[model samples]
Target: MNSRYVGYLFCGLAMIGVGSTVVVSKAIAAGLPPFSATALRFAIAFPVFIVVMRVRRVRWPRLSRRDAWLAIAQAGAGSVGYTVFLISGMKLASAADAGVIAGTLPAVSAAVAMLALGERPAPALIGAIALATTGVLACTIHFDQLSSSRGAGAFTGNALVFAAVVCEALFILLNRKLSRPVDALPLSALMSGIGLAVAIVPACFERPWTLPFDANALLGVVYYALVPTVAGFVLWYAGAARVSGAEAGLMTALVPVSAVALAALVLHEPVTSSQLAGVACVLAAVWLATFGRRLRAPSTAG
Candidate 1:
């Protein structure tokens, strides 16, 4: 079995883990204030993270002064900023919209990889990103209906989600830089700690921090803490190590598809013509991004 395929598998599962959070977060958002909801989930996850690291004998890295600040920034952007923007976006936008917006992460990550990491995208990747970008625009700029609340405020919500995506992209690049030698579990624990530092103060204002007893909400917190926060980070970087950042970016395109599917089934959000068109374009883009190179050359192992 190819390690690249293994990487894709880990990334795909991580994608699903991250994607499905939209519906869960939406449900949780109804019961808890956005900041509280974000804070509560990590509060549970971070302590468990410490336990897991200790149990697994994953020691923290002794980083240089520069790397220490880098880790803090990474945690701030990826964990704290990403969560704040995303949860707030979900509160304002439909889960379906948030799902569709998430598709942009791959394109954003690719661009970030190219500019920051000095990795140039091949022509096929460029084309695929164009298609995905068009799809995202289609989803966001709905010509048919602009009178409704969601439509009127869509920009604010979607923009925030897009900002979250950028933060996540930065996290991906930083993780690629940092985790070449550092283990994912310890790195995640450190990142989560910094995230808690950022979340705690804001969360304090929203406190009493009472989580809901509703099965869905409880499940949201538990799954978020375990699946996405703990396991998703582990699996994502584990896979990322075996593949290119471009490939990893391409892989996260699955986020919106899964998120939209779950949003429809769980949130009962309407599926509009724009959403249909956007999804079609996004799927096509993903197909191209993932396999377009193979049309020109023999597929190589990552």
Candidate 2:
């Protein structure tokens, strides 16, 4: 298979990893504080990455001082912010709602790429963004329950999740710029390590160690470390390296769709008709954004 095809395949697999993260994270949050869970996830994943690098004989890139700092900053915003806010959002909102909100991440990433990297989005891409945004709103906002019992916490949680999406978008843009000379594994390891360090201090202060200990909690931590933190990122970087920022952004729309489906199946969340429709809209939008150019063609002259 071609490298680009391989990259796309990796990205699709990464979205599966990203989708499953909500279920795993919700499980972890049941017995662990958000920050503590975040810390443990990265802390365990970092060493595994180091061992993998050693086994593969992958040498770390000699990053310049500026690139190193940029990587650290991106790690702070992306890994730290994303993990913390994601868990917090799940605490305050339904997993279904969190999934819906996360659907907007592709739009956020596209906007960040445009602003930070001057990569202009096509008109079809704009339409895709609109369709995806509509889908998110439909999934998140319960028309029947809007005036009945929707509280401030739900809205606040959604906002936090959106903030996490924006931070992730910025991270993607920064990664593209910094990844040119950097090896993906070492750069990922360094960034994750830095994020782990930042998260650990705050988690310690919050007394994550004192939280109830159980086999499930231990498994949750390990799952996050190995699946989402390590394997998910590897697939993500592989895809991002081969695709344009906009194309990469469009692919992330799958995360929320997959998450919602998984939540319905695994968590017993109700897959309401409206939510299913929203999922369809989001999926259609992603397809349009990704392949609209091919769909539209000019007549050839004989």
lDDT on C-alpha atoms for all candidate structures: 0.79, 0.78
Predict model 2's lDDT versus the native: 0.78
Pairs clashing within candidate 2: none
lDDT of 2 by residue, 124-215 (tens): 77877788788777766665655555555666667777777788887877787774567678877887799898898889888966766767
Q: What is the lDDT of residue 242 in candidate 2?
A: 88
Q: Model 1, stretches more than 4 Å misplaced?
A: 1-11, 115-120, 176-181, 208-219, 234-251, 287-302
36, model 2: CA deviation in Å? 1.3
TM-score of 2: 0.85
For candidate 1, lDDT tens digit of each residue in 1-302? 79999999999989988888877777666666656666777788889889988898888889877778778889888888888788778767778778877776766777789999788798877887888788878888766557776676876777788888899989888867753456678877888788877777878788644654566666777788888888888799889999887688678778888888888888788888888788777777776777777767767999
TM-score against native, each model: 0.82, 0.85
10 residues in a row with least lDDT, candidate 2: 143-152
lDDT of 2 at 293: 70
User: What's the residue-level lDDT of 92 in candidate 1?
Assistant: 71
